[model samples]
Target: MVSSTISLAPFFSLSPSASQSQPPSPFAFRRGLFLVCHAFSQSESQADKPNSWRQLHWKEKRPRRKANAISDQEVVHQFDQLLAAKNLYQINQYLKDHAKTSNNSYPTVFSLFTRLTQAEGIGPDEYTYAILMDCCARMNQVNLMFGFLGRFLKEGHSANNAMIFSPILKGLCWEKRTGEAATIVLYKMAKLGCIPGIVSYNIIINGLCKNDEIDKAMDFVDVMMSKGHEPNVVTYNTLIDGLCKKGEIDKALDFVDVMISKGHGPNVVTYSTLIDGLCKEGEIDKAMDIVDVMISKGYDPDVITYSILINGLCKEGEIDKAMDIVDVMISRGHDPDVVTYSTLIDGLCKEGEIDKARNFVDVMISKGLEPDVVTYSTLIDGLCKKGEIDKAMDIVDVMISRGHDPDVVTYNTLIDGLCKKGETDKARDFVDVMISKGLEPNVVTYSTLIDGLCKKGETDNARDFVDVMISKGLEPNVVTYNILIDGLCKKGEIQKAIDIVDVMITKGHEPDVVTYSTLIDGLCKKGEIEKAMDFLDVMISKGLEPDVVTYNTLIDGLCKKGETDKARDFVDVMISKGLEPDVVTHNTLIDGLCKKGQTEQAFNFLDVMISKGCDPDVITYNTLITGLCKNGEIDKALDFVDVMISKGHEPNVVTYSTLIDGLCKKGEIKRALNFLDVMISKGHEPDVVTYGTLIDGLCEKGEITKAKELFYEMISKGVDPDAVI
Candidate 1:
């Protein structure tokens, strides 16, 4: 029996070269069987001969019959080939067949899958079920992955291998299945004796935070501590980003403090996220404070952090502060990258400081920083705003020359600029150029051109652009309707503007404050005050709250129509709704009252304005003084001038002139002269109008000598007297 077994081993273990060339013949099988039977008979005949025959048969078969027993190296090679094809099904079949044939060794199967996973080309094998679970998690196929994992665990697979379960946990976390992932991780670690590492905890914490589960994420940190796994920098960063994204900037900062206290230093990403969140919330000063903290913590702010602060400052119209930050960044030995330069350029452009932005571009290039498409687009936008279409076009040429292809934004900037310059033909040509470059124009691009046409009073052409944009599969945003509404209103097409509003509603775009405000202002301008109010009613019916600007527009419109009582009612409605009337709102309301000869009520509104913490601007004083003087209330108007000066608000020429004119209109030549003296004493040189008003008043009062002296004084002060003199 021993000799027979040794002889049969040769049939299974043919030499590698011999087995590849040909299939086993029947003759070879029968010959091997005959040899085995002969050896066994011989072994039975003599006990000593049996041992000798067995040893001789084994020696003979050793080299020729060793193929059936796969080597560890061969198993790894086959497993890799299968995995490379992503042929998990075939790999499973191969493993099962090999395991049955190789005496069912679990170590061999485990080693095969593990080694294949480590190979460069081959991915993790199905035998390493954790990899599939991870893939499922990554693809958000949580249920399907868990089902497979359940089968794996039931089939005697060890769940204790962190190498196997950790990836699965990470997958679950990535899919935002944090609770399930946590439960699985805890179950594997406690029940199945698996212990998670730092990476495993990071995945869960990050997932929880991303899903806006902040409290849950913090609880997970506690769970990690309980499991004796301290959270790492990645873990803290994930939580910070999550909190920042949810606009919980204060909580994010607190997390940063906790991270530092725990000895995990925050990195650039952590700082950038916090800065961006603060900027979005308009807490720009607080954002800058964090930047200082970041610097003091020995963490240099990166390009992203700089971009956030610059954008925030720009949005607040604090261009100088934003530029200061940029200078500081350069002085700190940090070369401004493309985004940093782009942000600064964009901010400068938006502020109408085109020349300064252009000079910065030169400086950026000199410093070896190549201006990207965004940089060019920003410059183009600035130039367009300044009506420098020729310079903006030159920028486009330079962009093409520099091999930095202009995108939709670049085209939109140029087109918008040309539109603003009343060059609709040139703007249209740019749209064509954009299309020829294989770039489909977006709504912003089309909307820009439409707005340009509308501004030039070519509402029909603007409507054509809208149709073109729609035909090209671009849906018009809220701005598109606004431009058309404004255009139609300008052309006295109020009904058409209202129709466009209906279309906007039909298309699922609600009319925002700008939408209603533009239409209302237009209707007011066209003397369609009742229709404007009806539109306001419609806006409110749509659940859109009127902003302070909306109320101010209506008040100004009503005041212009001599309906001061109705305008005052609007103010009451605005304040009752807890909407603090802005400076513009107060000025409009006060101007209305003063115009209606209600000087006392108008001045009372000024007190209310001051009490509401709304500082009255120069316009406020000028409007009130003009109204009071027109109504023969010159003395009361003069009191407001003194109040304005005392409030630290510098009265400009308009404020002084309004009072001078009011005094003159009331035939109070001496008071007008006294006011002019007060104005000149306050370092405001009297203009021709100021002297003319006083001289004219003096002439009306027959004080010709005093009028002549005032005229001579005006001439001496280099104020050229016009024909009215």
Candidate 2:
């Protein structure tokens, strides 16, 4: 009896290209071959007599001319179909035969599985268990991947499965799951007797640094060095990039120096990362210095490097310097990219140079670079900033014409611009358009509209907008309340403003400085000075520092109350706290003192104001002179008048009136007449009060005839005298 076997190579001899390119009818040939093999196997029996018909049939079926030539393409195609339909059960069944009979080689099937896992929305299942673990590792699902690893081990799978551990660790590092990834990597490496490569260690260290676990990353570096694993340029660059991103630019530079000392040269990526960080931090000069360093080291700054610097300078309001950088880049044969152009346009627009920004857009188009949405948005914002609403709308129209549907930002910019120009109705219309386009109005949009309404003195409408905002699921921020408070205060609705403040606090929103100051100023302006003081006390108790405007309002209110002593004490308290009182604070106190007949005290404050490094303005001296004359300290008042003259402050009508009123009160009518002559000589016309005071003094001296003559003279001079005087 002869031993027999069957070959399936003849069926596979048909080329895949021929099968794919031709009709479906050729598939019948392959199906017929399978049927013939099945029939032959069914008819034959293993136990048979020598030279039996079954043995002859088996011998004829074995090998023939096409044995040992079967490819695994058909098996791979079936596996793909199963994987595509996510039929993991069928895949496991097929894999069982392929695993045992095919020398365990399934590269084609495994490759197909790898591609499927990489597809967006496709994921891994249990039958492709090893592949699923790899996918989990790639996606940084370390815990899930490790959990699967444990199940795989418990199911008595081979230890060669440990090969999946490194890739998993790498995935963890990439996903910034560093600490956990590192721990697992180290433990598994030890358990499997595997040593992590430099790339693996570098990845772990990079992740640690990114997480701001720099110390751990550095410790790992030290451990790697101790274990004789040399750190490469990539290792140093990773550390540098991480440090720069965390705003540790100086430390990053120091790392560069250390890298140089360790014979590892810094690469363009290292410099670019540092420059980008510096630019973002508003250290543009430092970033430029790094750019020079890169150039001197024979590294041409890339588009990103220049963009960073340009953006940094633009943000810092150094548009001219940013333009200079652009010129240098162009001069160095580097064509400005869209980002570079957008930065300049944004900076110019922000600086109120909309025309210049438009010119740049023309230049960008001439250079053959089509402006993107960012470019359009930047120009729109620029136009808005320059108050060029029509032009901005044109840009939006053009953007739409170019088939670039305006995003929420574009609408937001226009709405904000309209609101700023007090076009709340138009802004609201745009808001409706935004919602109609399926874009939800965010907090900024509502806040801008509310603020615009409040500015127009439409507090009720502003409050209504607030309700609309809340109904739309948007929470009002601190700014919303501040605007309402301001509006209510301006309308003399101080109590309502206070009620809003209470509501704000109840809603868990802490009252900011603006909140307290708005209410305080409103109270002070309404002559509710005591209530404002109570608010100040509450503000201080809440740990909020009163700003200079807060102090000024309080001092002005106290001055109005004729409480100069208390006002001065508040000024002293402000000074002791290192809060310098402004000229208004001094003027209020001096006017209060002069009104209270404390002319000498008022004069002293004038000098105190000068000594406190606040120059006495015309108001300061005028208030003091008026206070002194009202108190019958005419001589001292005259001296202040001279001081004001010497200080180049021209004496106006109030100055002459104070002098004339003071002299008349002292019975020095003739001298008052002399002062009036001098006043007119200096081209200072005597007002009605000046004439009235002198006329009243003449009447007191039995010169009624002279008083009547002066009264007629006052009418002739066009000075309307108050009837009481």
Candidate with top lDDT is 2
The TM-score, computed over Cα atoms with residue i paired to residue i, of candidate 2 is 0.60
Worst 10 residues of 2 by lDDT: 7-16
lDDT of 1 by residue, 604-653 (tens): 98889888888888888788878877887777777877887897778888
Which candidate wins on TM-score?
1
Model 1 residue 458 lDDT?
88
Report the error of model 1 at residue 401, Å: 1.9
Please identify model 1 stretches exceeding 4 Å from their true place.
1-232, 258-265, 282-285, 288-292, 295-333, 350-353, 524-533, 635-639, 649-653, 656-725
Candidate 1: lDDT of 163? 60
| Candidate 1 total steric clashes | 1
Error of 2 at 74 (Å): 24
Model 2: residues >4 Å from true position, as ranges? 1-259, 262-264, 273-286, 543-725
